[model samples]
Target chain A: MVKVVRNVVCPFCGTLCDDLEILVEDNHIVGTRHACRIGNAKFMHFEGAVRYTEPLMRENKKDDFKKVDYETAIEETARLLTEAALPLIYGWSATECHAHMYGVELAELVGAVIDNTASV
Target chain B: MQDVGYPVCTLGEVKNRADVVIYWGSNPMHAHPRHMSRYSVFARGFFRERGREDRTLIVVDPRETDSAKLADIHLQVEPHKDYELISAMRAVLKGFELQTDKVAGVPADLIYEAVEICKNAQFGQLYFAMGVTMTRGKHRNIDNAISLVIDLNAYTKFGLMPMRGHYNVNGFNQVLTWVTGYPFGVDFSRGYPRYNPGETTANDLLQRGETDMMLNIASDPGAHFPQKAVQHMAKIPLVCIDPHETPTTQLANIIIPPAIAGVEVEGTAYRMDGVPIQLRKVIDPPEGVLPDREILKMLIKKVKEML
Candidate 1:
């Protein structure tokens, strides 16, 4: 049976229409009502699309990314930043404020340049 | 521009009171599909009881976009000449006559008529987007438009807003301003937050090859950034944190997938009018997947320990 969730906020564009009705069946979104075309596509297709489910790592740019555990990925990322003289933390537009808080803290600790899409 | 702030209002106020709506260089029909029906043009409100019939819709663009099709008046201005058009509008509003027959491919008489409509409005709104911001004059176009709105206010109520693109783009600016004392392109290289747009901004840093590493979250710079910037990013040890695979992910040295915000994770996102709306979580993310905050927290802890 499909379950209907009303007043669901769309995460696609800045409009952030919050009156959408989402239809979910078997834990997957099946459809959306009162949503724009872009929002509808985002809701109906996100689950079935090719998504990165696990953390991945690659030693070199030419190498294929190998699946790694969260611990290893985080550790390696930290190591890369610690070893670098300067690093950049970019792209905070699509996420929420809590994540931005942590991102700011990480940039401070790493002494990195942090920016968002607004710069572009 | 921040120092000389312009008159503005919430989308709610616009929906209720706006009798004259001007879309300058923005095509809401394509970029923001529901913007017209929900707030600006068609929405029926307390004062705007008859919806579309009660409001005047005006669109200014170089081309006849879908949004322009619905406008009561479409000022098909010349490309990259928004600055001149705005200047002409301001001049006409100030009761000055133009010697030229046309300005920015728009007739001077039409501009006079448009200014008259704005001057007579009970409540008027002007919205601009990437077309104004990314054009040749860039910020100056916005500045001129704001000044025009200010001039209009001498006769009537007027407000202006930028048609922000990303869902939380405005939210990011709001949060960063409250925390760091500035918005975007912040550098912490000296143990203090410093903001210098052209120098510390991501594209400049990447283009100059000044930064040795990058931690990209949520946005896809690979697809959106210039070739030089993307090439520099491809050369660096880049870490990307996002829910889906993008061009940025393809070039990333490390990819960490997080739960999609506003879907699998609930958080506060500011609307285009600086109104904070709580995003709802209607479903669970894939097993073991976390939100951006969680991943960033773990990364922060790890980096702290390593340093």
Candidate 2:
């Protein structure tokens, strides 16, 4: 039997109306109810877009993109972040509170200026 | 409870009690289509049985917008003159004698009429959007509106709400204030939160060639930022953490896939009025994808390892 729970908040915008209901079937979001058009699109977007199966990197002047492992990408990203003198960690408005807090720590450790997209 | 001197009401109350709905520089039809149908003038509330007929809709904008077309009074005030217009309205409300021929394409007569409607309403609510804050005056414009609401209380019941762009943007501001003791776009690089919008804003940092690297969470700047700021982001070492591929992600040197919060992951968020809400996870994120929280934790650990 599918389990249904009400008052699920959709974190897509500032309204944060916690009236959405989720239909879980065998540990899957088979359907969603009581969400707006944007919320519905957000909930079901994964089924349409390519899930970024592999990490990609660009190689030369030709802008050749190559798929790499997740570790390699994360390491490369970390190197870039650490080496940065005035790093600006931007765009955290859509993330959860836990992620935002961790991001704060990362910014403090690297002495980077954390800016959300709202600044624009 | 936080001490808010001003009287505030939920969207539910606005739907029920608001007899005069004034949308200043906001297009709810496009930005918030459901707002009218669910919570404002058009909604069928207990007090408002006739829906549109029960409430007076007023729109004030520089242009004759879609919402303005349906308004009983559409005050097309000049752009960048929001402060002047608001001040003029306040003067009118206080029964100040007219000293000028006209202000911002709005005559003295209209100002008095506007103030009259505001004063006579049983419940008056003002909903403002980016148009009030994105222009040359920015925060000053909002300050005027807030001051107006404060002044309105002397006569009748009045309230104001900022048309927050995203669902959790207010939540973010609230959380930032709670943790860092500042609100919106806080800078913590100096081991403390600094709250200066223009100076500490991301665009200002990038345009000044001060920022070296960037880690974009779910928000997208490339889609909205100016050319100069966009160019800066392009030249910098950019990392993106988002569920979908966006315009900003196209230029990112590193892209981290994060589970969609509220859909694929569970978390807490805040509404427009600083009300906390909980998101329930419904779907599984892609096989290798991680939640933004988990990804940031990993990134923090890696950084610590490097140090």
Instruction: Name the best candidate (by lDDT).
Output: 1
- Taking all chains together, the TM-score of candidate 2 against the true structure is 0.89
- Candidate 1 residue-wise lDDT, A24-85, digit = tens: 99888988999999898878765556787899999998899899988899999999988889
Against the native complex, each candidate's DockQ, computed on alpha carbons, is 0.85, 0.55
**Model 1 lDDT at residue A103:** 83
Model 2: DockQ score: 0.55
Error of 1 at B40 (Å): 0.7
Model 1 iRMS (Å) reads 0.9
lDDT by residue (tens digit), candidate 2, B1-307: 0223335678888888889999998887777656777788888888888888999998989898889998999888899898899999988888897788688888777888888999998889998888887776877777788788889989889998877777667666666667777666667667677767778888898788788888888788889888898898888778877767778878877777777777778887766666677777776777887788887887887888887
Provide the overall lDDT of each model, using Cα atoms, as 2-decimal numbers.
0.90, 0.77
lDDT of 1 by residue, B45-70 (tens): 89999999999999999999999999
Q: What are the clashing pairs of model 1?
A: none
